[model samples]
Target: MLPQFFPPFADAVSLPESPASSSLGKALELLDLFSLTSPLVRIDDVIARFGFPRSTAYRYLKELCDAGLLAPASGGAYSLGPRVIEFERLLELTDPLYRAGQQVLQEIGDPGAVYLLHNLYRDKVLCIYKQGPDVIEYEGRRITVRRARGLPFPLFQGAGSLALLPWLSPHRIRQTYLRNAAEIASSGLGDDWEAFRRVLAAIRRKGYSTSQGTITPFLGGIAVPVLLPEDRKLVGSLAWTVAAGAMTEERVESCAEHLTRAAQAIAREYVKVAADM
Candidate 1:
């Protein structure tokens, strides 16, 4: 993996009941507990969640606090620490894709659309950077980008998420399809493997993906894969969302044209930045 770059994708797989992981890995996993519903965690929460022994749980908490990933909170609990903000700053400054995205977004310059930059993290799709229109809301409607950094969407959902499907290796694609066949069908990809392959093949040929209200009601998305110019390595995606009713065939084609141009520019910028590093 390249230092200061986005981490690569992981396979869609499940963990065993008592699988072995390093102490550091387990400590970092504690960050997953800090979500919308559970913003803080106590020692007992850690113990109950992971079945870690009392002493081991305390030790892990200490390690996390020392690392600046977690900090003590009111009433003997822990919350995500200030270091996460620092890391976000670091990413905005140094990450090639983000730096590139900033440039491409301003270049697009269209209002009433929710712009997004997505990257594959672990087994799910993550919206790393999101920006709503600055000038006005979408025709008197407020557009919200649904996928947050902490809350990831599945591989088979949304245009932004599904846009990444064609870029994965065949083996990984097969693995994901097998693991999520029901979801694939529900998303209208196909119930069977052959149909799933065909649908993705068409998406790969067209070089973008679009969906209407599949993930959010009355919303639609158009996404194009971003790849390294030289090696064609999949970086992530550049996508935008707008009112579902506005997406006629001509409109989608026009939107796709604009998105493809932006994605190519971002990919070229990423390549140049990577070379400089």
Candidate 2:
């Protein structure tokens, strides 16, 4: 929402407006500058760029950090902290897509062993929503979801990654690919641009991807894209990891069908929720 100082022209013409003091406004503006692509920021950078007084900015920053909204980075920088991660987890837990998918996942075979993976713009697979299964037994093999954070896999290599790639703007997709190019190529995405482009093109054509040898060994990924109804934008990917030994060609087909259906159901829920807003 626009602040009173930046009131709509129509409102400004008709209403007597009292603009906020510069310091308060600048503090809020500083927070807005942090984003996925640039998460870490320095206090001096914020003050110089946003024109907030150093004292005023530090007061705000100190409160924000003490309240767990932000945290001090190494060398005294600041970044979004544990509180925001907690809030995001709360949102995902409450999200209708997550809730509906949870129920559907339960109804399908082997609910105790099933888990769901979702991807968002910044952190890739936002987190795993595990219903149960401290250790999954699939085809007589065990798998576990331990340490959900800091698992970095290319946004191009897994089904969740490929599912997200087509939804991003061409510029953003290219930027992300380049950002992780050297590391992703180590996973055999390809060594150079031409080869990487070919891989991305194939993912677009195939409409999904099956990535083996991604984050967890002996676990294969199956992903499908979910389209937001409002603008038909691809929001994120829905994927699950299946034990590789259990993923015969037939099981792979089943996974695709099941995951696609779940994606559609979740997308439908997202549309309804968005419309309510």
Candidate 3:
């Protein structure tokens, strides 16, 4: 479960013991139902599918809506809201590094899917870009960004998240990773610490990371960390996605190289911005 402290609503529901009272799970499931495929959903649909009490369903939806996590559609249906969009914008524009990275992303391909930078805020990775469709083919599949803006994801689920690992101090990394490790491991991720350590170490050495079949079953992700040239601390990462069928070691490597160069260029720009400051 995503920790509530990261987002106040994450922990609002109460779960029961016997047969798993399932209130919390149901609430989360309800939110998952409103993804790109079903962006606009009705409360009645949630009620009908989950068999949640009308009062209970409304209560959770109201809370989400109030928090700006959800918005009312025509006919009282629900969709994602502007709050997430605003937050994502703030995350990008507030950081000179990310703004620079966005520019690099725009220039990298022949109108391909672009990228945005993200940080692990409140335990979830938050997106800050408005990307369009771009494609790279491998193994009979395509790689591209699924959508733009306000896409919240688990930090343990992709190349971008791994990129953030090397920039943290060993102490901070141990603490933060340990705290979230159990939750991450239990959340259907591989339970191998050794493997995670290797992945992070490889990212550190290579200056980029790639993962397939992690966040989305048939999608691949490639990412590189933005580092302070002087201190080399990880600020965030620039990333894009690929379809599972398009995943190939060679394609992943190509993406990694390009993303690293872009990240370095952005880092250079950020350094100049800081120097001016």
Candidate 4:
């Protein structure tokens, strides 16, 4: 029999008690515990976190191992498995935004700047692609582009997140505003829904958004949304980041112009590709 594939972070309590469903739930839960800061996990760590019995944890881990979702490492540790590499490869192959965004970045984005393509997933801005300079300094440590992908930013924060706000329906906008009112207020956008709506209106009129040190401390960004031409639906955002000190008015305007152009090109390509498909 073929092994059942488990969706990422599936809720265990929601699934019916078929053997595959039961096993898949536990496997997904196990995988959810892995993250950039904690990439490797031991059975004891899982036990400590989830309070699962040793045998039960081992069973779940073994199932994931057999399914190629987790691989054993030294000292009884397990890291994310080769299947993740395959899944990312499949994502790049299947996702239109990645290809179209790459083209947009190459054409309009500054070669030395940091550019990110973000999509709204589960109400958060997920960084699906990142293009960075040869050395990017984050919190005084230099990192590469390969290390920056897949990082998620909060939906109600950052220039990229603000760029997407105007595209949401009024009801969703109000809901999101209410859910994140305090944070939004703290960020100086608004203290209430009315103020927030005004801010979004201004962003829509300008065709882009800019923020200083909102997502990453000491960094600023300018972002524009990619909208589908036919239905005007929001697909994602294209954003460029620079050091906070370098975000002069002229530089911000220039970045916004570049971002807007790239966003328009990406949207056109995305719609064309979708129509062809």
User: Evaluated with TM-score, which candidate comes out highest?
Assistant: 1
Can you write out model 1's per-residue Cα lDDT over 133-213, one digit (the tens) per residue?
522245677555565544578878888887898888766676677677898898889888677777887888888999988
What RMSD does model 2 have?
Answer: 11.0
The lDDT for every candidate, in the order shown, is 0.79, 0.65, 0.68, 0.77
Per-residue lDDT of candidate 3, residues 136-159 (tens digit): 565766555553455788767677
Clashes of each: 0, 0, 3, 0
TM-score for each prediction? 0.85, 0.65, 0.60, 0.73
Q: What TM-score does candidate 4 reach?
A: 0.73
Per-residue CA lDDT of candidate 4, range 18-131, in tens? Answer: 332565666677886898799999999889987889999999899889988999999999999999899999878767888788767777646678888988864578888888
CA lDDT, candidate 3, residue 120: 65
How much does each candidate deviate from the true structure in C-alpha RMSD? 6.0, 11.0, 8.7, 9.3
Alpha-carbon error at 134 in model 2, in Å?
3.2
TM-score of 3: 0.60
Ranking of all candidate structures by their TM-score, best first? 1, 4, 2, 3
Q: Please identify model 2 stretches exceeding 4 Å from their true place.
A: 1-63, 70-100, 103-113, 138-140, 146-157
Identify the superior model by TM-score, candidate 2 or candidate 4. 4
Candidates 3 and 4 compared: the better one by TM-score is 4
User: Higher TM-score: candidate 1 or 4?
Assistant: 1
Off by over 4 Å in 4: 1-29, 47-63, 132-147, 169-182, 192-195
